[model samples]
Target: MGLKSWFSKLFAKRVVQKMYDDAAMAVQHQEQILSYLVDKGVKTEFGRDHHFHAIKSHTDFTQKIPVRDYEGLRNYFDRVVKGETSVLWPGQPVYLSKTSGTTSGAKYIPITKESIPEHISAARNALLSYINNTGNAAFVDGKMIFLQGSPVLDNSKAIPTGRLSGIVAHHVPGYLQKNRMPSFEVNCIEDWETKVDAIVEETLKEDMRLISGIPAWVQMYFEKLIEKTGKKTVAEIFPNFSLLVYGGVNFEPYAARFRELIGKEMPTVELFPASEGFFAFQDRQDDTGLLLNTNAGMYYEFVPQEELDKPHPKTLSLSEVELNVNYALVISSNAGLWRYNIGDLVKFTSLSPFKIRVTGRIKHYTSAFGEHVIAEEVEGALSETLKKDVAAVTEFTLAPQITPESGLPYHEWFIEFNREPKDWNVFIENLDTALQNKNPYYRDLIEGKVLSPLKITLVEKDGFQEFMKKRGKLGGQNKIPRLANDRKIADELKAWSVKTIASSNF
Candidate 1:
């Protein structure tokens, strides 16, 4: 092997070996980690009130610390952001990550000094695990294109605030920084369109081996590259590109389009990172689910997704979780979050290594008329029907049209197609049928007159992109909500498109 490949293989080996060792020890030594965190933060008001020093077990921890969302912890987080020491973690947070909010507007999550390394190492080990599994370490010899959120921070606060990606960007190791595309200056450009243009210009000629980002934005980048370089596929621009590492949003809807962009199959690694913490990642090539980061200075609890709205829902420890059951994830992390509900829904697919799949987001669902459709079901239905129809979707989202004046209320889908189906009506029917089959409540609504058949509104070219750009959310980390209970998004889409290309109004 060449010297560069030899060095890459050695690096991959060491990274994977360490990941394996950590995974093996994580569950076995979970209790010690819990105690360590508790003892470390015992002097804080939260810790003292929650009796962290006196806590003996998971049961005590749960009972003492009632489940909390960002709103519940905002006071403490604000204090920490205002330069308070030991307000949450042993010291003030290294940074504060700004994330989306429901009714509150915006959320600021604390990122403590101890938690920074977990984010970095977890991301590193995931890529290394992919290398070890596939024996494709040659990518390490070439450059990687990381299309992430702007690295710039809002310096108005005592601690700088930005997206999780931006926070992690500041902590990238020096060695890997050399191989990563887009200089720090370009990454810090706050305007998404401008930054993407810069990235395209800078990396178009580089020997890009891997591409990492959210699927939506990465697809945008690839499309731009193809347009600028007159390349039919991304593989033509970056001939050595072999791997796609991504997270933040489900890939099912965009997978076919991505493969088409590359003009070849590429190995992909999925990670489950949030503003709260880096939770899990795909550790094996054969496994579809992500393995939990049990050793990563974070404790976990799972409450049934259905019970999340309850005043006091049952919380399960790692040992108490069962396979295939949907749970709302609760985490106590080195970031100083205590039994915090991060609003993600996940299901365990395996137990021995604790692998899981993110099912949906808590606020990101459509329960209008009690149909209770989720992101997983919608994406699955779309993927299955599109595959069978031999069509490709570009982007899509759905919202309930509940206030129609004359006809029955229904769910309306706004979609942009890369390859249109031969029979548009058949495609709509199949999608509606698939959704009905997956959700019985939806079936009941369709069976009755409570809801009309799904309305498929074909939008004009680049409609979704326009919507995101208008909202100032056109980037790697931002995503369109797949399902919404209200018609706000749908109404805006109609206004944006002005006229639907086609519609299925059955």
Candidate 2:
């Protein structure tokens, strides 16, 4: 890859994109992948004691396995940690992408050898699409700089041992080292104050293109990089850098800030990935949702809301699922999981057996005063209101709580906005309209047919999320619950909102 050829590819991203789109869709090419999982069972049975038995008990086989959470899976994971070969398929795991753990209360998710190829493949597709869009693979001859998790692993004296991060450190092909982060021992999840400084200091040691990670963490990293190097954007470090890939959580929240940090036009890709599987990646580079790994080692299912509320939801197969609708995801992985609810809600924008958007989490809804307000509804309202009012609200969160004094409760909203004073009133009205339209129960609640009235609080300059980030719960799977209708963390947010609102009122 000479500089001339690199420039040609970078400028000819559309051509590269056409090729990736065709290749990704050609799942038939990997028939052995699906066959390997269904026939071999892999380690899919790790969590559920009944996972395999359930698969065998039912004549249909697929219908018997129930979805289990991380806790259910942890029991077997203990054996896996002991390095049980039976737990995982017999393959040398080349890379382990450590993800934040929600089940064991630990932080790193261990990716196995069976998963590395697919993980690399998903990343490649993302890259291919990006190059197609920008024609900039010409910049570094396929070199990319990954801003990754801590590499020190578990033991300081020995090689790093985190499941995911360690995997990347030890297994990422030596041929690919120059394209990697500074070292296998540096930690990106360091304490907030030191984290940005560390990334800048460590980054000074590398010469590369492309960056991948959670957007928020990257945003903070860029801030320090700017301060330390006096460079306004990441582009200044890797002048020809073209792609930014991020997964986990809604990308909408940090979009504006990242744009400001980048200071130039480039493709920012959204990836819909989970520990269970690398489910999807941005298909068109510029498109919002992700392209499903339908042909991967997983059989996908959807559970409708009505059934989800039932003792057991009726399930729909891949061919049976539809679009413009929300459904709980149930996956049967090569690891032998069947009907496992991953607790995510997604809607399809197209019907080509791939490409969909994750609207929100099944557990992240705000239901107060008999009104069920979901992230999707809030997202729609925010976007609709933004376009209609031409406002510039950077971030917003809905927090519903109960007052300890009276059994009665009210809803509180915190928004980081910079619109007109009168537009504030219109913003509230638009908020009401959005709520009413997204869910009917909210409309009745708004009309006083229900309890608690919704109150809006203008969060300080940086907003409540920034404050939450300051408290050490900012990035990666750490979501500020929108409607903690139960007051778990919503109580804390409520207390803060009240203090801010009251102080502002006075």
Candidate 3:
């Protein structure tokens, strides 16, 4: 065996051996973690204000602290921004995760000392779990690359602020740092295009075994490598490439295109990490849902998707949750975010190991015409339709076209294709049918003529990329808004589209 392979196998043995033995006793773990959090932060200003000292159980914790979105937690976050010690967590935050302002506005999420290790371990465990399950320790023998945003932090703020991926990059272990490709210098380049070029130049010849990043940005990197080396598939450039790790967006629509770039099917691990916390990961290769970090550093809560739109939603603890119901996720973490609604929606698939699938985002959907369609539904429809037509979708977005004066209101899709459908009309028809079958409200609107049939706008190659560049959001962590409540994105897409495939107006 190679020296690097031997060392990696040894390390993998240790990581997989040190399993969470108490994982089966999830309820006890959940209670103990909650109590620990309450005791640890009971003296903080937020803790005392909410009587954290009195919170003895999950029920008590829920009753004492009302659920809050970002707006509700803004006041505490403001105090943290002003450098107040022990305002939320036990001490001042060590870092602030400046999230991409996709939903509300740009948010500065606190990263306390206690929370740092949690983030690190969650990411580590995700990789280790995959290794344990797939017997793929060879993946770590060569090099791994994470396509991340700039790590350069802005210290002008009360706390150091940067993208979450950038912050995590700074914390990679020394040994892993040696095996990790693309030097930190290239990772901090602020320009997306420039960064991708630098990454390609730096790591093109390395023994790349594992690839990790948002699927969109990784596809860009693969394309660049192919163009530079005159190789049709990434496997031609890096023969040992084996594992693909990705999150931050649904991979279904991009899966076929990405597979084509790689030249063959490879094992891929899905993760559920965000600025709020690293929550879940695909443990077993064939499992559709990710295993929740049940014994990890955070407490989880779920509110029915229906109640989430209300001013005050009803929430359920992990013990009370059921399978198959869509729920908006709420979390209390070591970072001192208490009952904070992180804005992502998820549905439980299994309770034994606490497995879940990310359903959609709380704010990322369309309900303008009472046809409540979500990101999951939209992505699913596109993925299924494209599969039937043997097409590959690169990127897409939906926006409402509500011009009552000329035509009935409808949803317009802006699509960028890696492989166009042989039958264009069949592709659109199948997509519309898929959405209607998946969402009853959407079907009702189509049946009633309350809305026109869905329209497709074929975006030029790199159309979405150009649109993101114009908005200064062309990065790994940023994504085009999937569903807009208004015509803003639709109008902008119309201007950028090379050709428009208009459907008949109602």
Candidate 4:
């Protein structure tokens, strides 16, 4: 190791030690954060409206505030967007992270001066923890590429606005600026396809070691690299590439394809970051669950998945949660979100250290026949099936086929495969069996004859990519929905398939 690598290792050691110390006291840190937030919140307009002055304990907080999604909190957010001071947080926000929403067009999540540092530090600590665990700091010296959105900010709003990734880009520490790749000019090209081409041009021959992005987009970049250089594998193109950092979606669905693309096993770090807050990260190479950011400037609450739609659902604190139960994650952070429902469902893997694995979105599941199947279950089923079969999938999604042309209603799976399974019948059988084992409701429905066995529709190569492109959500933190309650997306895919078939015939 060089002098810089040596220094990084030393710094990582201290950071990792502190992280362990903090995680060991997860409940205490969360309590402290809650107190601090309430203390500051009492002065804000929202706090006053919610009678924060009289709040004393977590119970009092629950009585005073109701869990709310983005639409529920939009009234306060609108005031903040109009440049109102002390509307939500103590004062005007430093920036607003603009994210796409379903019912709401665009959500502007505040990032206050106090909270922005948490995002930066948590990401830095994730890396430091990896270095401490693996004793691999050599990647720090090589060119690092983060596939993300345009770093350019939109100042038309009261506060500067951009994607969360774009906002964090501006805060890249001065030391790493020299090592970060894809020049600012290339990063600013609003068009993702164009920007990727530019990135391919710039980093085709660089010593890339650390690559970070949403896994699907990173896969697209790898495909482009292979196409340009005729390289059989990404490992062949960048022999120095050592680490991959990914988030926004579960990595298991893409793991097999990634292994095929890289041609070797590589260390990966999974993060749980959102516009609301940076919540968790993989702290150990051997661990599947991400260590929750308990000591950060945020207090957490978990609502049992069954109680989410209730008018007054029960909320559990960090110390009160049970293991392996799906819970809708709620948070009150320094960014001024109070009892905010971020729409993510997570299951605790370890309660002692507060580690969790994201399961799915609260609203992003297929319950068409009353058998609720979530993203985690579907991903798990596919992953389990691949273990026994020689198959690699590019992308996949599930929806209910309520009215088929010639059969009973069943779940329809649209799959784009990198390499088709050697035995299609056996692959489908194994996948269905795994899913049934994971979700008992689905199993009951199948056994009762309410629904037939799931059917798979093979998508042409790049079909999903073209679908995303047509929807104008080609890249930068956008992800395909793993399961849908309705057929809006399924219908669109059907139309795309028709168009693709027609074009091919022509």
Number of clashing residue pairs in every model?
A: 0, 20, 0, 0
TM-score of candidate 2 against the unseen true structure? 0.79
> Per-residue alpha-carbon lDDT of model 3 for 1-506, expressed as tens digits?
56665666566567656545545777788888888889877979999999988877777887889999778888999899889889889888899998865555888899987788777887888788777776677877688999987889999988998888889888998768888867989987899999999999999879999999988899999999999999999999999999999998889999899889999998999999888888888877889688788776688889999897687678988889999898989888888889998888898899887889997888878989888799989999988997898899889999877774566788888898888888777777888989999899999998998887788788988888888898888976987778888777878877678665653332
In order, the Cα lDDT scores of the candidates are 0.85, 0.59, 0.85, 0.91
**How do the residues 1-506 of candidate 1 rate in per-residue lDDT, one tens digit apiece?**
54666676778898778777766776666777888878877979789767787788777777788999988888887788788888888867888998878766778898888998999988988887887787777887889888888788889988888889988999898878889878988888888888899999999889999899888889889999999989899988888998899998889889899889999988899999988889999988888899898998898889998788799999988888999999999988888988899988999998887889998889889988987899999999999898888788889998888886667888888888888889877888889999999899999998997998887777777888889898877886888888888888888888555343223546
Itemize residue pairs with steric clashes in candidate 3: none
RMSD, candidate 2, Å: 5.0
- Give candidate 4 regions above 4 Å deviation: 498-506
* Worst window of 10 by summed lDDT in candidate 2: 497-506
> Candidate 4, residues 296-330: lDDT per residue as tens digits?
89999999999987899999999999999999999
Error of 4 at 424 (Å): 1.5
Q: Which one is best on lDDT? A: 4
Q: How many clashing residue pairs, candidate 3?
A: 0
What are the per-residue Cα lDDT tens digits for candidate 2 across 202-320?
Answer: 77546546677766556657767877888777777667666777876666645555666778866778877665677887767556767777655666777776577776567776556
Q: What is the lDDT of residue 361 in candidate 3?
A: 82
